[model samples]
Target: MTDPCGECGARACEELFHGLLALDHSRAEPWGPLHGVSVSCFLLQHAGRLPADGGAAARGLLQAYLDGGLPAVQRLIGRARAANSHRVKAGAAPGGAARGTAVPVGREAPRGGFTVTIEQVAQGGTFPAAGFPERVRAWAAATLEVSGPHSA
Candidate 1:
């Protein structure tokens, strides 16, 4: 869990690393235009691993993507970066603004039509491209659907 991007809650930091790394197994960039959605969905679902601004930016981008399309998504990504909104850091600690328990996500992860960790997504597998791009869009859509209404 010491890895800043290990919020996926793998049994071990190595597991988490393998899971996230597996996304690139096909050596193709599937996120493409939906990069914001892919990232935002991942960030928002792991509420326990996100900073306040990160969550807001994620939710906002999803809303923007729905209301204003790619342009809006790009704009929010820029602003989020400026705000230092990003995957939770190791020393960020688990308290206050962070929702959900800071503990590592496990099999007990809630199924909200969205994955709680990169490992889960990887488990779906992506071979010969494995429809990674489509998976990202679908995952983003589901994340938005279960995320409830967005404000601002």
Candidate 2:
């Protein structure tokens, strides 16, 4: 295979990539959205804690976190994009900010629901630049066909 994206020294992004693959193999369709959940869980549980915001140092740390999963996320997005199926965009819900809307940091529902948004980052232009988690959530919602609060 031609280094499709000319990935240079991106070995760093492999760890998270493998984790995602493992997830894809083990989970069901609805479980698809769980990609972000599994990743976040792993990040929170392991890989040490990350600071949400800060200076350059903080940004570097976050980048490392992202880079760690860049490759895998790239692969997943490639598969989804190649499938070429359109789904409702995440965050484009009703009564709130649209997908990609930068909101104040707080625990708040973003309008109708979290809409999935995908953007090209680097080589191959299939991977996400930043919205990996949101995309996964959107994928889950679209594939699972579930919404609203669970009746307990």
Candidate 3:
């Protein structure tokens, strides 16, 4: 569904994007021990129609982030790191974050339309490297509520 304020909708997307970036920054050290340590993937699924001024919305989001300065980014990273550390201690698996069901809004997506996939590698803890892929796939399958080999 369309947000009453388009600016607010854009800001929400921007915040989520930044949060993912912060998560990446915090996981950097742990991920350093692995191959392809610099790789990251993000998928943003919007509920409604994209704004006509998508380019302008993107530019505004970038400008906002830039105006926030490095200190703000650092703070976000710090908080993410701390939360990740806590999760590790609690025996949670290290990997990309998972979001729950997507709430419907706006116009419905066309039948068999676009699909987004996000993948990330997490390090640290006793998790086996060889089984990581399987775990990720399983998680994706469960999250998307799909069956079969190409669930994600």
- Return the TM-score for each candidate structure: 0.50, 0.20, 0.23
Off by over 4 Å in 2: 1-19, 25-30, 47-152
* Candidate 2 per-residue lDDT over residues 60-138, each given as its tens digit: 2223334454455445545545554445365442222123332224422222122221111112333432554545444
User: How accurate locally is residue 97 in candidate 1, as Cα lDDT from 0 to 100?
Assistant: 46
Q: What order do you get sorting by TM-score, best first?
A: 1, 3, 2
Give every collision pair in model 1.
none
Top lDDT prediction, candidate number: 1
The most accurate candidate by TM-score is 1
- Each candidate's number of clashing pairs is 0, 5, 2
lDDT of each: 0.52, 0.33, 0.32
lDDT of 1 at 22: 57
Give candidate 1 regions above 4 Å deviation. Answer: 1-28, 32-34, 79-123, 127-130
Query: Judged by lDDT relative to the true structure, which candidate is superior, 2 or 3?
Result: 2
Residue 105 Cα positional deviation in candidate 3, in Å, after optimal superposition: 9.3
- lDDT by residue (tens digit), candidate 3, 1-152: 32322322222344444443554455543322211111111121232322333122222222222345334434545555676774466655333333433323443322212122222222232233465444333333332322112112
